[model samples]
Target: MGITDDAKDALSATGEKISRAVDDAREKVSDKVDEAQADAKVKHAEAERDATKAKNDYKEELRDHN
Candidate 1:
C-alpha cells in the first residue's frame, strides 16, 4: 500500500509538470503567430505605398509624353 501510494503521488506530479509544459508551449506559439501577423501587416502597407508611388509616376510619364 505504501509503494502504491508513492507511485500514485509521483504520477500526479509528473502529470502536472507535463500539463504546464504543454500550456507554455501553446502560449509561445500563439505569441509567435501574433508577431508574424503584425509583421505581415507592416509589409503589406509598405508594398501598397510603393505601388501607389509607381502608379503616380507612370501617370506623370504618360502626361509628359502627351
Candidate 2:
C-alpha cells in the first residue's frame, strides 16, 4: 500500500510539471504573435506615410512647371 501511494504522488507531481510547462509555452507563443502584429502595423503606417509624401512631391513639381 505504501509503494502504491508513492507511485501515485509521483505521477501527480509529474502531471503538474507538464501542465505548467505547456502553459508557459502557450504564453510565449502568444507574446510572439502580438509582437509580430505590432511590427506589421508599424510597417503599414510607414508605407502610407511614404506614399503620401511621394504624391505631395509630384504635386509640387507640377506647380513648379506651370
Candidate 3:
C-alpha cells in the first residue's frame, strides 16, 4: 500500500493515542511560549527601571559638576 493508506490505517488503529500526543505537544509548546513572554516582560521592566535610575544619577552628577 501507499504511504497515505498506511497512515490512514495507523490512525484508525491509534487515533485516540495520536490525538492525545498532539494535544500534549501543543500544550507544552504553548506553556513554553507563555513562559518566555513572561520572562521577557520581567527583563524589560527591570531594564527600564535601571535606565531611569542611571539617568537620574547622571543628572545629579552633572548638576554637581556645574
Candidate 4:
C-alpha cells in the first residue's frame, strides 16, 4: 500500500507539470498571434498613409501643370 501511494503521488506530480507546460505553450502561441496581428495592422496603416500621400502629390503636380 505504501508503494502504491507513492506511485500515485508521482503520477499526480507529473500530471501537474504537464499541465503547467501546456499552459505556458498556449500563452506563448497566443502572444505570438497578437504580435502578428498588431504588425499587420501597422503595415496596413502605413500603406494607407503612403497611398494618401501619393494621391495628394499627384494632385499637386496636376495643379502645377495647369
Cα-based lDDT at residue 45, candidate 4:
100
Which pairs in model 1 have colliding backbones? Answer: none
Better of 2 and 4 by TM-score: 4
Q: Can you write out model 4's per-residue Cα lDDT over 1-66, one digit (the tens) per residue? A: 999999999999999999999999999999999999999999999999999999999999999999
Rate residue 23 of model 4 by lDDT.
100
> What is candidate 3's lDDT per residue for 1-66, written digit by digit as tens?
699999998888798888899999999999999999999999999999999999999999999999
Tens-digit per-residue lDDT, 24-59, candidate 2: 999999999999999999999999999999999999
lDDT of 1: 1.00
Q: Which ten residues in a row have the lowest lDDT in candidate 2?
A: 1-10
For model 4, state the Cα shift of residue 21 in Å. 0.5
Provide the TM-score for each candidate, comma-separated.
0.75, 0.89, 0.72, 0.93
Query: What does the lDDT come to for candidate 3?
Result: 0.97
Write candidate 1's Cα lDDT for 4-61 as tens digits. Answer: 9999999999999999999999999999999999999999999999999999999999
Model 2 gets an lDDT of 1.00
Model 4: how far residue 34 lies from native, Å: 0.6
TM-score of 3: 0.72
How should the candidates be ordered by TM-score, best one leading?
A: 4, 2, 1, 3
Model 1 lDDT at residue 30: 100
TM-score (C-alpha, index-matched) for candidate 4: 0.93
